[model samples]
Target: MDVEADVIVIGSGPAGLTAALHAHESGARNVLLLEREEELGGILKQCIHNGFGLEQFKKDYTGPEYAERLIEELEKTNVQCFLNTMVVSLSPDRTITAVSPEKGVFHIKSRSVVLAMGCRERPRSSINIPGTRPAGVYTAGVAQRFVNIDGYLPGKEVVILGSGDIGLIMARRLTLEGARVKGVYEIMDYPGGLKRNIVQCLNDFDIPLYLSHTVTEIQGKERVEGVVVSKVDQKMNSISGSEQSIPCDTLLLSVGLIPENELSKEAGVELTPITKGPVTTETMETRVPGIFSCGNVSTVFDLVDYVAETGMIAAGNAARFAAGDWKKGRNPVEIIPGENVRMLFPQRYSFKDDLILFVRSAKPIEKPVNIELSPLGMRLKRLYARPNEMIRFKVSRDKLKAVTGPIEVSITER
Candidate 1:
């Protein structure tokens, strides 16, 4: 079989659906959303916790609730949806090869493509946590899905290996569900999750959080029995004689999320090493002219609101591409990371459109910080941000057009 659309979305997550919605509103009549999952909500279906949609919806909602709102909106649009379909590959010329049980194998020729495949958690094997392969080990997100969506408890006693948002949320959730949360360990001196999450999920639950620590080893054969944790020095080296062990039946890893870009790479899209997402411009257009990216697939976002906002930009640009109104020939400058700032997404910037630069600090900044553009040395924006928070600002096309050198964004304590 063969399919064709003006715009083809590779995922039906919030980013993809929002993009499809925006594309339809932007006058792209034939937009198709492809979802590999049996359902449309992506990982949100597993995340039942509240604290979502505070920005976009102006009200707090659970993950599923927020997704439901968007899904409902999608039903009123011209966007067509294909569930249980997997995009096998993509070509530079905007050709997509996908497969589904009912539709068999098919080729899709789209005028533009949006990549919103989102991200996946880093498994225990990726971190090389020396341990016997055990059955009780699960990523925090997976554990969340099991407990929240499937009504299944992962274990009775759990020790989380990272202080990420998922791990923190699970600590409270597992405890609420009648599990003993041993503790959450972080290799960094500070928590990896948002400070609010640390307070609400861990502190509020009285769950211990060990900072500057890591799981040195795991002791288990069939199921997780316990884990050996150790404090790390300033250099991240284990402090001598600071090892401790905690007995537990499960170990949940919430170390980090990595952007899903295998399909983007297969389609020959350039990627930024800092964010591990496809290199994009202000329009969210990737190196491949007709390919755009957003959401966790473009960069991990602290809030879903930003994902939806960015998705609209990608969708609008993709719609223009589909309408034959996309203009090429703009030279985009690379965004370079500087002091105190770990990395910035949309690694590349274009003067053709206003750029919203999203960045994270390398460490907590308690005082006000100035985000300045280097080389030319102009202050772009000022923010009072903690390391756990994300800072975003827009650079006007006029300002971007004035840059004669690479764009550098740095944070300096006020």
Candidate 2:
């Protein structure tokens, strides 16, 4: 079968669904949302924990609740949805090839495409932790699915590596499910997860947190056994004689999440080395004009609200691109990171509208830090944020209209 639409959004995650709804609302008559799973909700279906949709929905909700709200909203529109469909490849010319149980092999020619395939967690194999290939090691998300949705206990004893939100949440969940959580180990000097999660999930649960440490070796042979964790120096090297062994049947890793950009690469989209996603302009448009990306597929977001908001931007731009209403020749400005600032998104910026800059600090800050725009050295924004917190600052288009060179964001102790 051959399908045609003004906009084709890949993945039925929050990003894809929100993009579809936004595009349809923007008068894109033919918007299609495709999902590979049997259902519309993506990872959210397995995420039974609350703490989502405070910004978008104005109320705290579980992952499924947030996704259901968007799904209900989409039902009021003319947007079409394709479930159990997997997009195999994407072409630079806005062509999509996908297959499904019912449709077999199909083709889609969309004027604009939104790549919102979301992200996948990094596994133990990716980190090269030396040990016998065992059955106990699982990524935090996978473990989340198994425990939350599959109605099965992963393990009675657990040791989570990396203090990412998922791991922290799982530490609490496992404990609630009558599991013994040994501790959470993070390679960084501070927790990788949000401060709220560390407080609520780990600290409140009495789960020990080992910062600046890592699981250097896995001791399990066949079924399971234990792990060897060691403290790491500033350079991430294992400190001599600092090794400690903890016995546990299962090892959960929440090391990191990587944007699933294989299709982006196949479609020949230029990706940023920092985000590992497509290099998007302020409008979220990729180098290939009509192709836009958002959500975890572009960059890992700390909150789902930001993902949905970014999806709206991508979808709005995509709708305009499809309608041939997009104006060209906007001068682009680069966003450069300053001292102690890890990285910034939307590598290229346009002054056509207000732009929100999302950034992460290299380390935790105990004192207030001024986030200022430099080379004019104006203080665009300020926040007292820790390393685990992702800070966002909005620069109105009018504020950037007069600037010509790159926008520099700096952090200084106050």
Candidate 3:
């Protein structure tokens, strides 16, 4: 099959669905939405929690509900959709080759492409726990799918490694399902998930969160019998005498997430080493002009609202590109992170209008501080900040125009 669309969206997650909707609304009527799953909702289908859509919908909605709303909106439009399709590769000129059972080896030549392949969980192998390859080990997301989607209990006893949002949520989930979650361990003193998740999921459930702790070894051979955990110093080196064994049948890892960008890389988009995602401009356009990126594919965003906002931004710009109204000109100023700042998405900004810079700190700030974009003279007050929580600031064009060079963002204690 040979198909063509004004905009080709790679994933059917919240980001891709919104991108296709906005693209269609922006006069790019021939928008195509593709999903590898049999359904359209992506990971949200398995995420049955109720914290989602608080920002976007101004009310608490479950993950599936949030995705259902977007999917419903997409259905109201003339957008074409292909489910259970696997995109093989994307070319530099915006050509896509994908395969599906119904439509074998289909090709698409699109004017602009929005890549929203989302992210993947970092497994135990990435951290390389000193233990045998056990059958009971699972990623937090896998456990979520097992319980939420398949209605299968992973284990009666669970020990979670890493305080990632998924792990914290799973800790509560397993506990609710009558499983004894021994504890949640983290190498860093601070939690990796949002404050709300830590409070509602872990603290509320009476699950102990072990700070500066890590799993030193996996004790079981066939299935998980127990794990040896130890306290770590600032350098993350294990303390010899601090090791303790916690017996459990399952160990769910929630270490981190890696952006799915092999397709972006194959299409020749330049990615940042820190983000492991494409270095996109303010318009969410990659260094390769016609291809755009948004959502978890651009960076691991904390909120679905922000991801949808990026999708709209990319779609608007893509519509302009498809309409021949876009004139690619000056280079965008680099946005760099300085002291106490860990990462900032949309690493490169070129637009002169108002734009939002989403940032994460290197450490948790106990005292009040000001997030300053220096040389540009832009400052915003943040009462408190955490490495796990992303901070967003809207910068005016006047403030941005004051800088002739790259801008550095840092946190200054007040």
Please give the lDDT score for candidate 1: 0.89
C-alpha lDDT of all candidate models, in order: 0.89, 0.88, 0.90
| lDDT (10s digit) by residue, model 2, range 1-414 | 399999999998889989999999998989999999999989999888899999887899999998899899999988999999999999999899999999999999999999999999998878999877778999999999999999888999999999999999999999999999999999988789988898999988899999999998888668669999999999999998999988899999999999999999999999987788888877898888789999989989899998988899999989999999988866787888888888677778876568877887777777767887877566744547566777876777877777789877778787
Off by over 4 Å in 2: none
* Ranking according to lDDT, highest score first: 3, 1, 2
Residue 211 of model 3: what lDDT? 94
By summed lDDT, the worst window of 10 consecutive residues in model 3 runs over 346-355
Model 1, residue 350: displacement in angstroms? 1.6
Candidate 3 clashing pairs?
Answer: none
Candidate 3 Cα RMSD (Å): 1.1
- Candidate 1 lDDT over 20-135, as tens digits, reads 99999999989999999898988878778888889888999988998999999999887899999999999999999999999999999999999999999999889998868888
- What ranges in model 1 sit over 4 Å off? 380-383
lDDT of 1 at 93: 94
Q: Considering every candidate listed, which one attains the maximal TM-score? A: 3
* Residue 129 CA displacement from its true place in model 2, Å: 0.7
Per-residue C-alpha lDDT of model 3 across residues 223-259, encoded as one tens digit per residue: 9999999999999999999999999999999999999
Q: What clash pairs does model 1 have? A: none
